[model samples]
Target: MAGSADTLFMPITNGEIPLGEGQWLYLGARAIDGGFPDELRAALVCEQSMRGAYLDLQMRGMNVSPRVDNTDRFSGALILIGKHRGENETMIARASNMVSAGAPILIAGDKTSGVAPLRKRIAAFAEIDGSLAKYHATVFWLRNSVDFASHFSSAKTSPQGYQTSAGMFSAEKIDKGSALLAEHLDENIRGDIADFGAGWGYLSAELLNRFSPRTVHLYEAHCASLEAAKENLSDYDKGQISYYWHDLTREAVGKKFDWIIMNPPFHEGRKTEPQLGVQFIEVAARSLKPKGGLLMVANVTLPYEKTLQQNFSKVNQLARRDGFKLLKAQL
Candidate 1:
């Protein structure tokens, strides 16, 4: 329900307000153009890797951070927010917490994305000053009052026996595709292993509980999800688990892994792009040691087999159900 990038950036392009000089934090900034100011020291906080990569390519000389968690404390500056479904309330609370009192906050999104409701919610903590409606998108500005401690304090728990937060993929329950992949995971998975795009430590926890691997590395892009993963996996052997807040498409770990498990993301926003999965496969091939293996799950209709064949010496389908396929590949 989010508007196009152009629609979201219309206010900035139209010269509504000058993006002053300072440390600016951009929350949920998907791939957009023309709104960014060149003069400001901007840091973009995006949860999706594809959009982060695209914004990195477009915005040179800007700091591109992965996610906006509670630990991130910035103040006395402007914060731009691009609203999206499932994460609006969390984001507003986070923004209220991060920005200092009297700092400006700007929010832009389409009507379908609940911008009006968000405006109502934000009004409780900040005073709305100005707004613009154009191209089916609404852009509004407010000043933070620093009085929102009661709205957001703890993470949400799921029936799957793990902690998750708003905006995480399948936070309410275990994803069917992930469940399918976890069921077919090889019991012989040993040595150091990595899970790309790990969400809330589900697969990593399962792997550690089922196999006697020396170490397990979990790479996740969303800050809330990674924090929840840390909480969910706290009871496990701490020395054997590692958590990274990283964008897999741009950053790579230094060493190769004995095995890799992935549920690579395939969408930029709402649009499906199989190339994202293809890029994951390419990265997996490069990050694996000689004869190392990869276990992946994807939609059955996605053309990942061709990319797998090109990247690995062997590729085979291990299981398929409910329009999803579990694949195993080795070099």
Candidate 2:
């Protein structure tokens, strides 16, 4: 189960702990409203695309960095543990390594998110000073200590030699939908190509290995996925590939592509939001040259046909199997 933003911020709302002054790093903070304190120098670290929600915060004059990572090394960190065990462990371990030896770290999550077990795991590196239980959530604090770098070693590699990290989409194996999309990809596909929501470079790797496009641009929102993609695609000609940690909903590549391929995500966290996929279609339409084409795969239930027909001069269903449908659209 996923924890709500309210549950994650309950400790702060109840005045159990304060968002003190000085540099503060916030991990997995996807939502921020009046509940957040205004006094601290805050940096919001999130891998997902938050362009729409972040712009709202900016308009409200909230001073927070939209992106931050372990490299930022803030004086303190406010972490909201996620549902993925490996991701939670990695965040805590990295944050422990980044902060000063005696700096504070606060973690919060709901019971369903496994905060209790996470508290125990964190005890290996730091001492839990205090904890609060309210609103079906638990929040705890600790002082950073011990170098936990070893806990997060190199990303796991699959038998196929793809480097994948925990918590990324289809980390354990190549996604069936992506594999289906790959099977239908034409070997003659040439020219500059873009892969939206490219997870760990699976489709991009296939494109490079098969079509050998002149240049392939990969856009991914997740930092870890982007890192894995870099390692997995290292053998390809460096100049022929480009990677971007981008949010497609609110930003554009500023350059058009000859062909674009994607297995666009239809969900934001656990909720099914087909509009996110629609936005991707719209972005692909705008990013494609007048004669460019797009090849995309999505779940069968998603209402993307209307959006595709609206954006493309022609929409063709290429393949459908195992609850996924592949589409080919042209401008």
Candidate 3:
């Protein structure tokens, strides 16, 4: 259990903890360092702040919550938890389940990714309020009942038609990059293909229709994204597609691919972390078979060219317009 003096929870892979005793509790999304305000350290310095927990649902890879040997129990108290699942649509589903089972909820995350609407959606089950901070806001709720699964089950966004949880990025409509990628995909991008950072199967759907690949692998780190991605791709014919709710960076060892497509996330929440893009390129190069190709789309400002050049011997500019660049590299 986290005390008021402790800023963040240690770490855990994918797991749960029994509730503990306290007046005010804080529950964070997966891991400790990745989600929290700079003020978080200060926020945990109060007596009430001693009551906190972390819900780490990331399937695998880089964002995997740190594993703690023992989990402290929450003995039924007012607990606040944060929610930031990197474009995953099932966060609300997880939160709702908690709130319904008698846990007070506190949500926090970036506004650009629909945190406000998630607060409203989660409010359907509890008393919710929000507060603004530097990069994101913290929303809290204390309620009697909540329907965790239903709040997320009814809504669907087409680009791939996955049921969306409120906080997932670009949930309102088709993601701009996905739309652009779908528009430009060629009929020849066949064979076993992979979507690195594949969120909700948007681009995968387009590839399935355009190339009819023998197998389409959708890899996402966050469990919510993995869930939504699976839900979206489930509509397609079985056996032709497979989904892995694991970190693409640490996906099953020795897994090889023929083609990889991605619009890798450059930012982790509000921070401009270009390392994510570079990491994706590195992973793509390692995952591809010899002569296999990797296609990527990113904002022109991002320095992906150097990363691609370092990873692949043949890197070419496929398209460059509208502040976005499409690059292709082959091993």
lDDT values for all models: 0.72, 0.77, 0.57
Off by over 4 Å in 3: 1-162, 250-253
Q: Write the per-residue lDDT of candidate 2 for residues 1-331, one digit (tens) a residue.
A: 3344556555555777665545666666655434445553244443332345555455555553444544656677677776777777777776776677777788888777888987887676567888877667788887776665664443554637898866789888888899999998886567999999998999998888777788999998776687889998898856989988788987777989999999998876567899989999999999998889999999999989999999999999989999899999999
> What TM-score, over all chains together, does every model reach?
0.76, 0.80, 0.64
Which pairs in model 1 have colliding backbones? none
Worst 10 residues of 1 by lDDT: 76-85
Query: For model 1, what is the alpha-carbon lDDT of residue 321?
Result: 91
Q: Higher-TM-score candidate among 2 and 3?
A: 2
lDDT of 3: 0.57
Ranking by TM-score: 2, 1, 3
Instruction: For residue 17, give model 2's deviation from the true position in Å.
Output: 3.8
Q: By the lDDT metric, which is better: model 1 or model 2?
A: 2
Q: Each prediction's Cα RMSD?
A: 4.6, 4.1, 8.8
lDDT of 1 by residue, 33-152 (tens): 544454433544333333345356446555555554545455423333433444665666667677666776677776666777777776765678888786677778777765654653
TM-score of 1: 0.76
Q: Model 1 has how many clashing residue pairs?
A: 0
Q: Choose the strongest candidate by TM-score.
A: 2
